[model samples]
Target: MNLENTLAFAKRQDEADELRDFRNQFLFPKHEDQNFIYLCGNSLGLQPKVTKEVMSHQLDNWANYAVEGWFDGNEPWMFYHKELKKLIAPIVGALPVEVCPMNTLTVNLHLLMVSFYQPKGKRFKIIMEGGAFPSDQYAIESQVKFHGYEPDQAIIEVFPRKGEDVLRTEDIIIKIKENKDEIALVLFGGINYYTGQWYDMEAITKAGHEIGAIVGWDLAHAAGNVPVKLHDWGVDFACWCSYKYQNSGPGGISGIFVHEKHFSNQDLNRFAGWWGYQENKRFKMEKGFIPESGADGWQVSCTQVMPMALYHASLQIFNQVGSFEKLRNKSIALTNYLEFTINEVNKSLGTNQYTIITPQDPASRGAQLSIIASQNGKQIFDGLMENHILGDWREPNVIRLSPVPLYNSFEDVFLTGQALLAITKKILKSS
Candidate 1:
């Protein structure tokens, strides 16, 4: 993979990509009458071409059928998630019954925590990666507080060694072991949203289980961006949002994964709503709450048809493309190409001007590369935006560029590199 600055090389890579046609499936944003080189799929994925049609179908159903749309519409609004389960199951590597699409990400996290995070007298601490997404931090803190525990005493945060941006597997295992007796749950993001580091979920799950702790994940950045084997990983549970990389539109509905091992366990308490009741008798409005079996039992409300339609539209593309293996294969090559080009830019800058804080190993990262823009972070980011290269900035010094496999091309990466180089020169000159 000799990725270079040559336009011919980028064209060759695009020509060779089996998934190259997928780039056209998205609605790319434009600036100054030209489409921007969108490399921020890890933040919010590009809109799928089918999304509009799907949304229209739902809107038409609403207009024509009114409240009866829940049952009489072409795709019943009541069971919209059932239509989506088959599509999403393969992406996360789970059984259809083990997965359910519902709520937003943070809401799902809080719900899962309510069921999984049972803090008792001695074993009450919750363990998580330090500097987790603020939503996750708030969810955990609120869960701990709800349990009548102080967050400082009940939440234990594991951090990398001083001055490090990523956590080592060995260090994580050791931390879990040290707190084995007190930890009630081990909740972590499948991939660090900021660092783009894919944690070893299987190993972490095993460690947490050995300590008698429930293990769960927030796969907001990992769901459609990487290969996941949630069931085989023996994870107790997991949740993810569909907006990022999944291309389900902004604030899209989220999903939850519950291992079948817990399916028959009647004692598992959930904050149930009418939607979580047995489907056959749901409209009966029975006196006692009889929760549905399996992961669907976790549902707290009726489906949001609009978000579900958009999610189904995107998942239909995933289905046609076969597996995440296909997407992930292209993702690794695409990200590696971007990394190689960025490195070349660093060399040309003559002082290691750009340093990628993301893991060098393909196995440890998704498509995102977090570049630390040392001297002129904001200036370089703003300049790249001016060139119609849409990436995201995480305050202070880091800029994240994610070349989504579904919609981004190799040429986009090449152009982004060019934009960075130009931005660097402009910023350096100004400084």
Candidate 2:
């Protein structure tokens, strides 16, 4: 995969791409009547063209059926989530019974902790990646406090070795083993949000199980961006949001996966709600809480139809694509081209103006590359924005760019490289 920095080379690659037509399925933002080169799907994915139509159908159901929409509509609101589970199962590599579309990401994390993070005897500590998304850190800290454990003592974070930007798998496994006796749960983000490093989930799951700990993942960044076999990997539980790489709208529905092995464990605790009661007897208003079988038992309330409709629209596109393997293949090549172009900019300038901190190996990362600009990072980011090249900027220095396989093209990556090179030259001349 020798990548050239010329636009002609990029155009040639685009002409050869089998998935090139997917770009037309999304609506890109415009600047002065021209489409911007959008490379920020790692944050919020572009909306599908069919999203509005799907949402409108749901809205009409609300208008026509009103209270009876739950059972009367073509796709009954009562069983809407069931359909979603079928669509989502293949993406995360779980059985339909093992997955449930419900609640927000952090809320599901908390609910799962109720069942999986029961600390007893000497096993009271929770191990997680350092620099996790702040919500997860807060959730773990609060959950530890609720169980009468001090945050500093009960939470152990495995950090990268000094001078490195990503966590090493060996370091992670060693940490899990070293604290085996005290660990109650091993929770981690499927991919580090800032560094875009995809952790080896299978290895982490096996290591945690060996230590007698419940293992789970916050797959906010990993769920749609990379491949995961949650059930086969023996993960105890996992959760993800649909907004990012999944291409659901902002603040879209989140989903959860609970291994079938946990279904019959009556000893496990859950904060029960009526929605989680056995569906056939739910309306009977029975006495004791009889949990529904499988992951559906975790549901706390009725579905949010509008958001689910938007999510369903995106899931249709995912179903059309048929496999995450195909999307992942394109993702690797797209990201590799971006990385190569950035290096070409550095070479031409005869200075290392941008340093990519993401793992160089394709297997260790997804589509994102976190770039630390040598100087005036924010100013350079602003320049990119002004040039209609949309990417996201992190604090202090890094600029995160993700070329989403579903929509972004090779030409978009080439335009980004050209813009970056021009901006760097302008900055150098002024300085």
Highest-scoring model, TM-score: 2
Task: Tell me the whole-model lDDT of each prediction, alpha carbons only.
Answer: 0.90, 0.94
Candidate 2: the clashing residue pairs are none
Candidate 1 lDDT over 325-369, as tens digits, reads: 889999998899899889888887887888898999999999999
**Where is model 1 poorest over a 10-residue stretch in terms of lDDT?**
1-10
Q: Give candidate 2's error at residue 26 in angstroms.
A: 0.7
TM-scores, one per candidate: 0.98, 0.99
What candidate 2 gets wrong by more than 4 Å, as runs, is: none
Off by over 4 Å in 1: none
